[model samples]
Target: MLAALATFGTSILSALVPFVNLEVYLGVLATRIGDDAAAALTCAAAAGLGTVVGKLVWYWLAARSMQSQWVAKKLSKESWKRTFDRWHTTLAGRPWLTAAVLLAASIAGVPPLLVMSLVAGALRVRLEVFVPTVAVGRAVRAWLILAGVGAVLT
Candidate 1:
């Protein structure tokens, strides 16, 4: 339980601070836990939950900023409005596609989950879709990393 809490806190820190590197932390954790696959999984779940919660802070900030007058004025420009509208339409119109992309981004970190969280919020993607996709993706990623490290260590 204490380990889980530490992993959760570390994961959140990693999310908020780009240089923290959750993977390295998880690798070290994997070494300590040794061949305890279940423990690895539990830690992964805690980490995943923490990551999403941390990213939600970014999402909330972006969403709130979008409501600001300055942002509204900037978005009022034709080009900016067009871009925003395009993203909004694409994300809102196709929920499954948005979820899939977000999930992939969370797991692969190709487009960067931090950026995706902001994009999702700015575009008003539903939390129902956002939370599960990100949580599952991050959990899967953590599990894979833990498993690989365990394999290598053994």
Candidate 2:
């Protein structure tokens, strides 16, 4: 349980600030525990999910707040309008788009949290899909890292 929490927590941390640098933390934990693929994957997934969840909260607030004139005044060239349009048409209304969005972000090396938070706020993707996607991506990333470690050791 604690491990899970830690994994999830790190993801949240990384999500909020793009420069948080989770790799050091992740690598340290994986190395210190004597190397376990499943454990590494679990931790990475949890952390990624935590970040996505945090972004979701931000997205909600931003979305809710955007439904007014006051918020619009602060944006440059009325960016919220564009954000809303893109969010609704490309992401919120579509399930496959969410996966694609998430996958693209991951592939582009966009920080998971930033990706999730922005998508959640911008697209308002359903939590059900967002969370699971995060888990799978993190798991894959962690597994790859473990594999690299194994290669180095041998």
Largest TM-score belongs to which candidate?
1
TM-score of 1: 0.90
Q: Give the number of the best model, judged by lDDT.
A: 1
What tens-digit string does per-residue lDDT give for candidate 1 at 24-117?
9888988988889889889989988999998898888888889899889989899989988877877787889999989998899977999889
Model 2, span 33-66: residue lDDT tens: 4456667666766766675666666667755865
What lDDT is obtained when candidate 1 is compared to the true structure? 0.89
RMSD of 1: 1.7
Q: What's the CA error at residue 116 for candidate 1, in Å?
A: 0.7
